[model samples]
Target: MLTAQDDLIGHQTPAPFATSGAGDARFTERYWYTAHPIDGSELLFDAGLGYYPNKDVMDAFAGLTIGRRQYNFRASRRLGGRPLETSVGPFRIEIVEGMKRHRLTLVENPSGISFSLEFEASFPSAQEKQNYRERDGLVEEDLARVSQFGRWRGWIVVDGRRFNVEPAMWWGQRDRSWGLRSEMRTDETRPPVATHRNFFWTWSMFQFETSALSIFLKERSPGKPHYLSGTEFKRESDGSVSHREVVAVEHRIDWANDPLGQTIANGDLTFQFDRGAPRQVKMHGLPTRFYLKAGMYGGLQGWTHGDDRGDYYAAHDVWNLDDPATREVARTLSDHVIKLESAGDVGFGISEYGVATGYPLYEGPQKFPAL
Candidate 1:
């Protein structure tokens, strides 16, 4: 059951900006957006912005993957002004119509990538159930997140060339989440300890010509089972949306070694909705990939608030494409465009798979086991 406060706290329209919450340093607000061509052009672009209230820090990243090459841009700074007026160095985000529409703009940065894109929701934003959990002296409050499927309108320029973005050709997904995440460790003296040994998370959004489907899952420690799962399907028949809690899930991942010798996995996923039949989906890796290694653009191994040096500073590292090791790692972290076959209908979208710890991809005792 839900209450009035749930509606007030979960919706994005009324609260389009960040709020000072009781969680302090753990309180974080962030946005992730991705756009890809539907005509199989093999071009992918993604960007994300994160704000930490307790630390008064803001960070943003943008990446473009073309052919077998990937370009990344990143920036971080101390929060100086209003949170709603989004601006971080050369990157800026504008909320055009509260939750219904938003715009992301990036001027030419050191990475030589710039874009002006607008995301308008095709359906009302869907909020996940309040995720409240207490374990091992840690208490997680209303860790609320909302997601929406939408189309992109604007243009993206790479180097000096311009590519126009149209709704008919380009579609994307966006999500806003605020809460205490394990990745928010910035304090120097009091470092965050590992809460769990290993966790597997997969988030996917499949967009069809007239409908869309989104699925989310999280598995901890012994990766054979999942701890949480949810699904949302919007049908074209009457423009109605159906929400279901996934009852069970089964997946298989084909493992490969990256340049750094780290294991990466990509594979097929199946979901069983509580009210309906099962759905099958296959994920295919793209030639270009995002390297999130320790010091790399999106890697969590580095601290965000330290002096601007080493892994702490926002920087881009190009891979040695000729080297077999580097090429293997890129193949592991690369984005996967997925194909879905369900109920005699087909759909296409992006898929994200990650493993925080353990080597479930290999046969061995896990490196980090729960205490």
Candidate 2:
């Protein structure tokens, strides 16, 4: 997630393009607790988080609040490109350092349980898809990337006490690219938020939405089809303001105990689906390992959401089906079939999965839009 840059340095302004030091980038997080069997297990506590300062730059996101009963969360690392901005009332925060922007936020409050959150957002600008094409947008070297700078940050979590929160944090990132909507030619920096030299793995699909909910993140990969999937949709609902759907697809993955946390899937050919309830559930375990984590000795952890997953903690970072990441390791098990389904009146779905043996500037197969 990198955007916003005019470029200068020796001239007068502009000199915030940051991020260097490839990736073995280690960042691990976990938060999961659900109970709607009667809102019993305490009331509510739902959370999600993930971060990878290596592999290409990654961040995460997920929402639901009210003190550990259904959903309540907070995660961080938005320093500043030196940037750090704050407000607090309704929330208007920003934090950037070494190329900022890769953040997430959600708040409802409705009173009652009270985990805190009324209304929030932190966007100093950070979004990427630089010159991609297909539907008519026209530029698609598969999907070009390079030229970065983005900033977003928001944080707060208390009551149960997990950890991390030095200055609240929102986010921001940079590599620089400001052509406005370039078709002309603009290249500043990017394409290296996470690079293990290069390996190729493509079989794409991942989309997101905001109205109520609409989710899909699929990739068959039986014979070979790795579009690296993710998606969530919701244009705007009037149907009494209720809409949700979810699907989880990931047949295998292994390698976790921290290092960066990589036990993506090991349910032995997986599938998970849902709708509504879990705060319109479309989650995959909610956190712990995202952006390809795995380290003990083999050393391998990954994350690089700049093609425009917008970068990490991973917005809605989901995929915690039944718990299985530590106690056994073997390349962090990633093999797929994960399915989670539900739609309307409350719809939701999830599939937090993966597998990799290649990426030399990894880019292949790319095609996603289950509309």
Candidate 3:
């Protein structure tokens, strides 16, 4: 099938855009965005879109948090007709100006949450370290991603209440990645040997007035990393961008006494630069959180990413954030609003944290303090 993307000069293989060179069903592309207030507020929003070319499916989700309640909307449809189309149901993402500006909108629906916001980048996009992994000789993940810091200007209406979004008061981050991610795919065959049970990961990006910092780490055990990178992007006076290398990164988290011990109460992230003394940033957790499952990252109910829902399918629901039982099940691989402080300056960003069985970062007695 020929589509608009086929006309572009960017083709890895001698096939149309409707076809993926990789035969694996897990070949996918995704776009994600998040917006929150610079000043502490009970409002936050995030949305994501995923396209599974091999599976012939495309899905997208949007979520909004107000106080202790979170409203969610999800949609899935066949991946055809318009190969370059980024809209699913009522959601659409428009690239007004390549990497500089984007417009995201959610029309009125039964979910009672909709918005028309534009994201304008403050700094140019930076390439992140590759996320590649394999287990038992099977390529589990091979992806490349780029991240940017930006501001949002628009309005959001939730439950009939309208909240105006101003670029000066709101800030956000956007990332685009494409590759073979096993989390979005299912494995029907069991491995002959049991794989390791431990997994720990944390990704955070913070922006101050003049510079932004991003730190990413994945580990199977303490002091062992599958991938790690710390980068600092600075804006120069001549409209040029410069990069600062981070020699090392260290983190310590105080877990909250929750059901699964996955919630973080606070933490300290120290970045050791190549030329200067280490910079320490303190993180204070907020009351609100965004569950990744809502966007089909892990799984939502019986639905998983890349699943063939139908030619056209859509669903949505609301979750009560105040319920302990609900939060217990939804807290895994979640996003929490964090207040960052360092060198007398304060910033806000999201702390995306997840832990599996054998991570021992805070296993010692002294690290497990009373919440």
Error of 2 at 282 (Å): 21
**TM-score: model 2 vs. ground truth:** 0.24
Q: After superposition, which runs of candidate 3 have C-alpha atoms over 4 Å from their true positions?
A: 184-196, 237-240, 259-261, 274-277, 364-371
Candidate 3 per-residue lDDT, tens place, 1-371, comes to: 77778778988987777777456788889999989887778888989999988788999999898887888899999977766889998999999999899999999998898999999998778777788888799888888888888999999998899999999899888889898876632111322312334666788878777678877877776656778876787778997888776767777888776653367788888888777668888988887778776787656666778888998898888888768766644645666788888888788778787665555655432221111
How many residue-pair clashes does candidate 1 contain? 5
Q: Where does model 2 exceed 4 Å of error?
A: 1-89, 99-133, 136-223, 226-250, 253-371
What lDDT would candidate 3 get against the real structure? Answer: 0.78
Better of 2 and 3 by lDDT: 3
**Deviation in Å, model 3, residue 95 alpha carbon:** 1.1
List TM-scores for all candidates, in order. 0.76, 0.24, 0.91
Q: Write one digit per residue (lDDT tens) for candidate 2, span 241-301.
A: 2222334443333323334223322222232335533422222232322212211112112
Q: Give the true-structure RMSD of model 1.
A: 6.5
Off by over 4 Å in 1: 1-19, 132-135, 140-142, 184-199, 220-226, 256-266, 292-335, 355-371
The window of 10 residues in a row where model 3 has the poorest summed lDDT is 185-194
